[model samples]
Target chain A: MDNPKHGMTLIVKTITRLTVGLILLFGIYIVSHGHVSPGGGFAGGVIIALSFIHILLAFGKEVALKRISYNVASFFESLGAIMFITLALLGIGSGYFLLNFISKGEPFRLFSSGLIPLYNVAISFKVGAGLFIIFVILVTFRLTKKDDRE
Target chain B: MLELQILLVFMIIGAIVAVKTKDLLSAVIAVGTVGLGLSVAFLILKAPDLAIAQLVVEILVVIILIRATIRKDLPFSTSGRWFFNTFVVFVFLIVFLIFGYICMKDLPKFGEPIMKVAQSFLNNGLKDTGATNLVSSIVLDYRAYDTLGEATILFTAVIGVLAVMRKVGRKK
Candidate 1:
């Protein structure tokens, strides 16, 4: 806590900067490949959120907030929810809540799944933004002994 | 299977350490270790998806605990009614063991299940959902409503956190 400005040691910061992008890329790959891979929206979204939080930990709070402002995170979350609801509603044509209305493509290909990939994307958006907001909120309202000292 | 048993032992040790540790940080670490062990167990159980989800949830849980215990200190040795608590726990354990034993006769055999739904999915998941992965098809197509509910839950939780944490009349 000597130098609060630098959130962590140089090694952590360097490592974080190097791997954050890779983590983010991996998360995207997982989300996009949900129809074929073991991971889907939830796991990939968590990894994406972790990447942002990693940036926050390696750098300071201010820097991380700058990259994903509160408004932007809120927007992503809302948009994801709306998109999901709309997709479900669109299934009304097929007489179900979330019927895969879109014609199912050839199996085993990236573009095969009817609506699963889209749903995965929506879920990822919701999860990633929600997780980041939870982290940000917790960090902001963190309990401290500073009041007693003052 | 042997590796899984070893990890389960580690998990049990970690659980005991978490329960018995005086320091909150040590307790968190011990619980996290148990989480890691559980993820490994999931991997051994042939569920990489579960393992990934468990690992991520474990990390998020540690973060939440760290936030909650920033300056709070709860001593492990502060209880004076330990005997009463232990007695109650033992009573509950015995009751549960007896009940489980009674129910065991009716339990299905291990490694074999009446998996009609699973068999159908295995047979026609790709044809139905055009997804090669049966897990994905089941999650997003067959159980899309469940997925929707999960997303809604996350959305509501974030809104709850925002309502609790946001500064009044202050835009940042």
Candidate 2:
């Protein structure tokens, strides 16, 4: 049996690892700078998705799946969604939903956006988890089913 | 205007490519690029919130498409009726032209007085609502019901996906 890692030559492996690392770092940058810049939760989320895609393409779906299981991804997605909705419901007591019912402590500070930062965090988690789950489920079908050779 | 024109051209190309592609996977990717273009346009229009929402929704839609396509056997074909395709293209052009004309004619100027009013509300209304983010204040407090409905939609989608993808004979 050929090892899955054998699928990629040394150069390819190095490039793939570098690409994945850069993409993940870029995603974090986008998410953190969301309030101050144009890139926010959604852009950051897609960046993370691209990172996962790079890993899958470079290392194969089986390796990626092993690192991030379908079940765990789904659970993270569900949990993120639940957390977002719960934050919204907290607004209902004050006659609104998804309301940042907190006070903006200061201007132009990381924590100054009140619940905006928190919301961004939640959205990032939801987008990342959702995309990962989708990719896993879709790619699993292709990886698992082998052709019958007589 | 030049940049906008270039972006518009790219968007048109992406859309046309998406429509003409027969391979489901490639088509899906083209569609995603088109969506990314649209989101960029939204950002240029100074609607960051809408842009973010568009990006997120587009990602979700593309993921859904990928999952659906992977499960099914789809064949790619380049052959189709030319006249029918031309007719569809003509219809799309006419509809889009009219829509663009209306938008150009009637849309509010960016940073209009109403926007200032909204900004003031966010500035002052935070104290009353006890909210930090102006956007969040607008979304959750001023339009709580809308947020609830949006959340409900997400919940429904989650339930639907779970139901469709659930394994058979798996008892709780």
Whole-model lDDT values for every prediction:
0.86, 0.69
Q: So what's the TM-score on candidate 1?
A: 0.91
Off by over 4 Å in 1: A1-4, A142-150, B76-80, B169-172
**Model 2: runs farther than 4 Å from truth?**
A5-9, A91-99, A142-150, B17-172
Q: In candidate 1, list every pair of residues with a backbone clash.
A: none
Return the clash pairs for model 2, or none. A88-A98
Top-scoring candidate (DockQ): 1
Cα lDDT tens digits for candidate 1, A108-149: 788877888999999999999999989988886743455555
Candidate 1: TM-score of chain A is: 0.91
lDDT digits (tens) for residues B81-116 of candidate 1: 888999999999999999999998787775677797
In candidate 1, how many Å is residue B40 off? 1.2
